[model samples]
Target: MSKNLEHQFSMLVREVRKEFVGNGPKEISTRFVGNWAISEMKGNLTNVEKFMISSEQGKQMVHEARTKMVKQIYKKAEVVNKFEALMGAKVLRMFSDINIDEDIAMTVFVFEQSIESKGK
Candidate 1:
């Protein structure tokens, strides 16, 4: 991607990710891989999240729950449309993962066309 488009994509990714997380992350970064936009977020855990994820079993449960939540969100056409609008491409797929213990998350949004191709 060109510098301008890269910057724009990064900014939009951060904004959208903040909305997804209910609040913005303490730190966030977005990168491109083929036609995919990969966003990573790190933040402090909410008290409820912290309390619920105290044990190893609890951590696994919370992580699975987070995965389910993201899958549900991606199932919505409106959500996909919103991302495509922001990303300037048709979205092909989305995948997300979270680490409950580290309070970190990674989400990848795949577009039908490469971002670099669009930039050129």
Candidate 2:
């Protein structure tokens, strides 16, 4: 995909995260590979979350909550529709994971067709 399209996708990801999670990552980079749009996000932890991760139990709880919350957010019809519209393809699946220690996250969207080709 072109750099412009990738940038748009990155912004869309950031916006979705901010809208649902109440805070967007400080930085995001997105790339198209095969039928997937993969995004790497940095600085996703809020001040409260940063403090919570200091305890082992708090760290586990935060990780579990964040992971489940992200999955549920992506499963929403509105979220799925927005991504499908942006990529011009049906969404097949979505995957997300976060590392509390590093305050980093990765979100991957799988489309029914190659999004790279659609961008051309």
Candidate 3:
């Protein structure tokens, strides 16, 4: 993704974290993945597959959740503008193979992204 999009995604993650403070990074990771309807697709999903391809409605719900999360970060922007800013962009893509300790993975990725961007 472009740096601008990556920055925005990072900001979204930060805003999500801020809203869930004291619940800690594990809670943030849970929230981030909360709306995914991948379980429905798991009937066909293989152990090697990281993501589940879902129905249109499932995808729509996921989109809406992402939008809601982004809006929490950039509330002053118009809806269209916020959607444009947040859509299809990520600073760091979460792994398809979830680690045994996924929360640790998420916290590390978030901190790494922030640290890497500091001097840029």
Candidate 4:
């Protein structure tokens, strides 16, 4: 995919996350590979979340909540449809995880077809 296309996709993802998560990552980068779009995000934790992660139990809870919240948001038809339209392919599944210690997150979107080829 062209760099411009990738940037646009990243921006869209950031905006969607901000809308749902209340705060978006400070930075996001995306790469298209085969039928997948992989996004790496940095500075995803809020100040309160950062404080909460000081304790072992708080760390686990924050990790669980952050990861599960992302998955739950993707379950909404509007969210899935937005991604499908952006990729010009049906979204098969979405997987996401967050690292509380690093304040980083990774989100992978699987498309039914080769979105990388389509972009080119």
What is the lDDT for 65 in model 4?
93
Candidate 3 Cα deviation (angstroms), residue 80: 15
Candidate 2: pairs in clash: none
lDDT of 2 by residue, 1-120 (tens): 477888989998889899999999999999898899999999999899999999999999999999999999999999889888887889999999999999999999999988876566
Model 1 TM-score relative to the real fold: 0.78
After superposition on all C-alphas, the RMSD of every candidate to the true structure, in Å, is: 2.5, 1.1, 13.5, 1.0
Badly placed stretches (over 4 Å) of model 3 are 23-85, 88-104, 107-120
Q: What does the lDDT read for residue 84 in candidate 2?
A: 84
Over the full model, what C-alpha lDDT does candidate 2 score relative to the true structure?
0.91
Which candidate would rank higher by lDDT, 1 or 4?
4
TM-score of each: 0.78, 0.96, 0.25, 0.96
Best by lDDT: 2
lDDT of each: 0.74, 0.91, 0.32, 0.90
- Clash number for model 3? 0
* lDDT of candidate 4 over 1-113, digit per residue (tens): 56777888899889989999999999999999999999999999988998999999999999999999999999999988888887789999999998788888999999899
Winner on lDDT (1 vs 3): 1
Off by over 4 Å in 1: 1-21, 117-120
Clashing pairs in 4: none
Report the lDDT of model 4 for residue 117. Answer: 69
